[model samples]
Target: MLDANIKQQLKTYLQMLRHPIELVASLDNSAKGRDMEALVLEIAECSDKVTVKLDGDHAVRPSFAVAKAGEAGRVRFAGLPMGHEFTSLLLALLHVGGHPPKVAPEVIEQIKGLKAPAQGGHFETVISLSCHNCPDVVQAFNTIAALNPAFSHVMIDGGMFQSLVEERKVMAVPAVFDQAGELFGSGRMLLEEIVARLDTNAAEKDAEKLNAKGEFDVLIVGGGPAGAAAAVYAARKGVKTGVLTERFGGQVLDTLSIENFISVKETEGPKLVAHLEEHVKTYDVDIMNLQKANALARTDDGKLAVTLENGAKLTSKTVILSTGARWREMNVPGEAEYRNKGVAYCPHCDGPLYKGKRVAVIGGGNSGVEAAIDLAGIVSHVTLFEFDSKLRADAVLQNKLNSLPNVKVILNALTTEVTGDGTKVNGLVYRDRTTDETHTVELEGIFVQIGLLPNTDWLKGTVALSPRGEVEVDAHGKTSLDGVFAAGDCTTAPYKQIIIAMGEGSKAALAAFDHLIRH
Candidate 1:
């Protein structure tokens, strides 16, 4: 055995090596024992704030692949931090010692100049990209990992870690695991809360555990137009409502504008959603934003169990689904580049903005032909391109489109390229299948009138789905499952109109009320 004096010296040296004041080249396992010992002893003799740099003699790249807790000195018995992720390794060393990484000046300023040491606690950040829509949220967690090593962070990419995601009941991105091991915060978290959770100990854990127990009368699982309407309706009825949403505005936020709703002639989609939010908030509903619904299980007691992104759960007497649909996009070259710039999907939304402009319509179906004829009256010209040999629209609409003098019907043509001048669209390139020729149509906008597909894949087995994948519901918005009902674009409704979704939401709420009273 080594002398007691030698062991003390070695331990002190290891502590110094891990200090925030020092920068290490590499704490490689390949280093000779004697060489390490000598380095340690030499550093012990130095001043209180000794800076012992690692000897650059080992591979640092493939060493710190993943970071974890170190028992006394070594972590995971592997300690091979890999990649230029070596940067993460450095931050890990800093965590067991120095303060959390400093936030940017702007972020620091935004937090009201609040810079307190993180509470002495633990947080497990869980993320699952089942829909692959929340990458920004995952980046937020990675930034948290970059902050302090004392914070144990693991990314559960559901695509890669399906079983773990199922076991944890994670259905969305950015689920926060609290110190109590009970899931706490779900979805994107404010950085201040993250800082507060760091280094927080057991006493606080007990309190948080007690604070998370409560149930709602009605739980709304979406924050779109229909969902928002339902929330307002339920809360006003004094049913004690709760709203869980992946995004606060749901699919309505993606809309550019809305002219159909019974509003002030025209309104932007986001503005309309914001107004709806105000109405919903006027009631007493519990609002949980940026949260994705994870699971729906019926408790043995017959209460509806709602699992969320972070594994936290709630009990509800009735559940309403208002998560809406996304507009279909033609992901062709330049199409995405000019979307919202020159490529618009909803004619009723961005039509007036393009008055007297030349526009190209890409589908030959009913919606496409109608949009083309509509634009021909407003825009300088309209070019309708269809992949089929003939238009699939109704006879009346087809005759109307053909009768429009300014509308040019390009039969058997497919979009190849959307050439643009960065800010706006210049022209479109088309390929004719019959002639085996390609040409470009110089225009200001390309309106995508392709049919829309509802975003109901997440509900495939959660609730009943139609053959086309939309949620199946009755006129009263009752679903196949008890205590569960659906509305809006995600359901198998005939017409996908704003008024229709709102009307359905009202019906769903009444159904929920009746179900709750009966039970």
Candidate 2:
């Protein structure tokens, strides 16, 4: 993008110096000295100048790839271009920018024909939209588009443009088409393969409009434990898999600490998310990040069309719903403000990070008791606050609580305010419920073991849901929808344990496999 203000001002200045046709004609890849563009490029780069460093053999090396006019021109990266990196897109942008990204001469010729260069340029979706649980495809498009102004990059929402999508006959939402409306690629397309198409001129814009079918061996939704497990299984089984999640990590990302995930021993949520991301990257799974399924429909052919937020459609033979739940909040003041900073819901995820620290555990249920007991082992002190006169946990847990020296159980207590040092957790103000007495409890982190809400609003119309809105699935994790399957805490499973979620995820994957194979 040109400097917004400067871009506007320069657009005016350029308009004064050159007309639209002159500017349009000057856009050829053969230019070395377009005075107006050169001036604009220098200005854009100077103002939006970002430093890019890529990991090298031993140390980080600097690369100035994108012209100041573009982002990560050839230098700065969108993020770490590791596994599922957008390296090709970066190269594409360079090709389109004056340098004209080099495709085989044939591919270049084909691409030139994909769009009438006169209609101006091509449209691209760069940078995978990381909306929520996801497959990050846009990243590749963005990296290339940012560096080359010839391509207009957009973050996709599968539910927004039904007309453009239908005109292109888009079967799977992420399908990239050229200006001529020809399908370029779907799923994880290799840079070379796509580049090859640039010159093929052979593939028509409406090629997809003619294809009769679209299917997936397994389609796992949600990117939490269950969805991740399902993806790894389906991929290893040689099943053509497509994993879609609005975000890569579900509520799990907000988890601060996790004490039990099997081999993990103890870890933070982000690290756990990173590990899962690494695990899934090993196979041929299409992970869509930030792409939400707006409506799930049964196509005439019986496949599923996962309509995304941007009006794109993705089809699959079997679908896995792993969208998980979120922690229930008290909705108290300061609670929302210090969410990740201090206020937390899972003690297992963030416990150790606050070692030798003071934390308050709310509620007197099994989770609250468990959190207090767990925190007692790592933090300096554990303050367990209960609104009732006594702990409502299991007798055994209550008995164990009495034996803990670092745990403090406060009866009929309610949190009034959270006092923090802006950057981190500092202290809190609490009140005695029975006597209506207010007292200040100096604390650092507050673990609220209240409740949780499942992320399944979009599934309600398609699948049967429990009173709480969780998708109702059978023992094998099969939903009421024929080809639709679900897993993890999002199901009606009673215990929200990590191992159980993984087990259910595997079950859903296997069940989806069976369904896909049988069909």
Candidate 3:
């Protein structure tokens, strides 16, 4: 089952294993079981420290577990771990075989110190192979399971087990569940976030530590492309640079594919974000991830102070606001109530859940039209609603959308309400702009692709903002506040693209440096 190139790579990675490991397969007479057996056997051939066992008794059929030799496995895969999960499988193998993980030493120690609840903790994550956000969640749980025996995790492929997915009513990828109930809904999450959720005193401890941090010369408020670029530029100037963000990568982490990133021919969002974080790490920038900024103000000393949600304050001589935008939501009733139930923002991640079911794509821009075209293959039918008189998508995309038999585009249609059964979406309500008539379409899912809204709500009274809530910045990326700057989608930039954001971030960094020197 393993290709020659993959086998060679596996051999090289396996050389790092310090202890023997076993690939225990739970198989049946099905083709998938045979494939699993073959994969395990081929994996065993790659290294002397690896072995395979076929007499596994896992509950999930055609499943496998990667365990240290002679020990019970805590991490299991219920389906073939390919696509984005291929790396997850490799990491599980290496980590289980005594190869140290790349996580911080403190985090590793924290994981080891964690104690499960009285009922015990067993996390089960439902994921799709095409999902870009699932790998991090899977690897996180696996890492915890490897470090602490009190916790165990299983990665269930939703595509492979449709019945289980329907039973759980999971409409999105990376849905995590514990024994009590849903641990985390669909989204990208980090190990730190997971640990904080379980460890009750973690937030207070983290806040105390953050409050003790020294002042920075240049502090960035986000960790997207803009924040990352600003960090690199500021750190190169030999100043104390720090990046404070709720999570690195921001909205870009939800993005699927990028073909217009300048020199790079093609790449995935997570892959690019990984490279961005790695590049930033090569500098002297201090990265503080998984921390949200709640407010901004000027200190008595004239330095800028950014407050965190946990009541911790960080002071900096110069600040750059790169808090990027997020998907614009339709404030209609039932939309927020049924967010992950049937309403989704990312088509690439949640489209598979609505396979063979009817759905609606709201908006007429490139994102909406592209979603319709992509969903045509998986969904039974796609009804696209555009409020404008005509589609705003590119001509090429419009033409392609028109060719799909499963997709139907309606112009001059305004979405007024989202109708659901209190649990999941069942229909949609819209109005005809020309006829003044209302219509409802019964569907199982709704994909919102209208546009992005700036994440500058926290800076409303602190900075001069445009009507659209974007930070009003000059050509030099300088905001109205002295020693303060803004960039990327959160600012009044003309275009909202990755390349543009990076350039703006660099410009803002230089402007901040010049201001520092002048002061």
Candidate 4:
């Protein structure tokens, strides 16, 4: 199953194992089962410390567990951990084999201190191999299960386990579940976010710690490309800098392919985010993740005060707002109710879930057309709807979209309401703007790729905003407030691109520093 180069890489990684490990597989007589068995055996051949056993009687067929020798397994995979999940598999092997994970010391301690519920903590995450977000969540749970035996986790490939996906009504990637019901909400989540959800006192403790921190000379209020660049520039200027964000990588984490990042010919979102984080870490910037800014204001003492959702208040001499934007949602009735059930935003992440199924793509812009084209390959058919009289996508994309045999496009069509059975999507309602007529199309999924909205709702009254709710900034990235600046998609920047965001962030940082010295 693994190529020669991959085998060599796996052997190198296996050399880091401090103790012996075993791959215990439960397989049937099917072809997939045979493939799984061969994969385990191949992995065993790479390291003497690794052993394979095909005597596992797991309830899920074609499944396997990576366990320390002579110990019960806590991390299991119900499907082949390939594609984006390959890293997760390697990390599980190394971690279960007594190799230390690259997690924070406090987080490791937190995992070790978790108290399992009376029913025991068993997590099952439904994921698609194509999803870029699934690996982080899988690795997070795997790390927890490996660190503390009290918790166990299983990674289930939704594409392979169609019955399980239907039973759980999961239509999105990385859908997590526990004994009771849904554990945490779907989408990308970090280990800290998962722990905070499990530990009731975690948020309070974090808030207290944040409140005790000293004021920063250049405090950034986001951790996307813009925020990272701002932090780097500010720290390089010999100023105390801090970055507070809900997550280190903003909407960029959900992005799949990024080919227009200037010098970099092509790259993936998570990979770029990792490099950005590593570069930021080389500076003296204080990086704080999983913290949401609830409010922003200027204190009476001439300092900017940013309050977090956890009730922690931080003061800074100057602040840069780069909270970024999120995918705009369809405001129809059933859209919100069936968000992850049938209504998804990222086509690249969730396209695999609807294989051989009919789905609809809303919007006729570049993102929407691209989504329809991408879905046409994985899904049985795609119906694209546009409210405008003509498509807004580029000529090249429009031509390509029109050439897809499995894709259909409709102009002057407005999405009215998403139709679904109480559990999952069944159909959709739309209106023909040209004829004032309504129509419904039966489908299993819906992909919305309209646009993005700025993450500046919390700064409504504190700063000046455009009619579209974007932060109004000057040419130099200066906001309405003297000491406050804005950049990235959250600001009134002409274009929302990674390189543009970084440049604006650097400019905002320099502007803030200049203000500091003049005062």
State the lDDT of candidate 4 residue by residue for 155-193, as single tens digits. 998987899988888888889988676545688989899
Please say which candidate is ahead in lDDT: 2 or 3: 3
By lDDT, the best candidate is 4
Model 3, global lDDT = 0.92
Q: State TM-scores per candidate.
A: 0.50, 0.50, 0.98, 0.99
Give a tens-digit lDDT track for model 1, residues 1-519.
235674465445445434433323344445333344344335334434434444533332111112222222221101222221223333434443433445555433333332333442344444332212222333333445444344334333333334544455443334555556656665334454443343244225433442395788889888887788888888878888998776777656545457788757887655777788788888888877655666888899988987765556778889998888876777789987776567877564445445677888989998899889877877799989999999999999998888888989999998889998766788999889999899988888888987777776666687889887788998889998988998888898788877788888878888898888898
Task: Return the top candidate by TM-score.
Answer: 4
Q: What TM-score does structure 4 among the candidates reach?
A: 0.99
Global lDDT of each candidate: 0.63, 0.61, 0.92, 0.93
lDDT of 2 at 453: 82
Q: Report the lDDT tens digits of candidate 2 across residue range 1-519.
A: 234664455333332211111001112122322332343344334322222222222111111133333232322222222222333323323333344443346434543444324443454332222222112334444434443345544333332333444344332334555556555455333333343344343323223321333567787778888989999988988988887776676766655568877787888665687888889989988776555676888999777877765455778888888888877777767887776566766565445445677889988988789888878997899889887898889999999888999999999887888877765567777788878879988887888897678888887678899998989988888889998888888889888876788899998888888887787
Q: Which 10 residues in a row give candidate 4 its minimum summed lDDT?
A: 178-187
Candidate 2's C-alpha runs over 4 A off are: 1-215, 246-279, 337-359, 365-382, 387-407, 412-445
Clashing pairs in 4: none
List clashing residue pairs in candidate 3: none
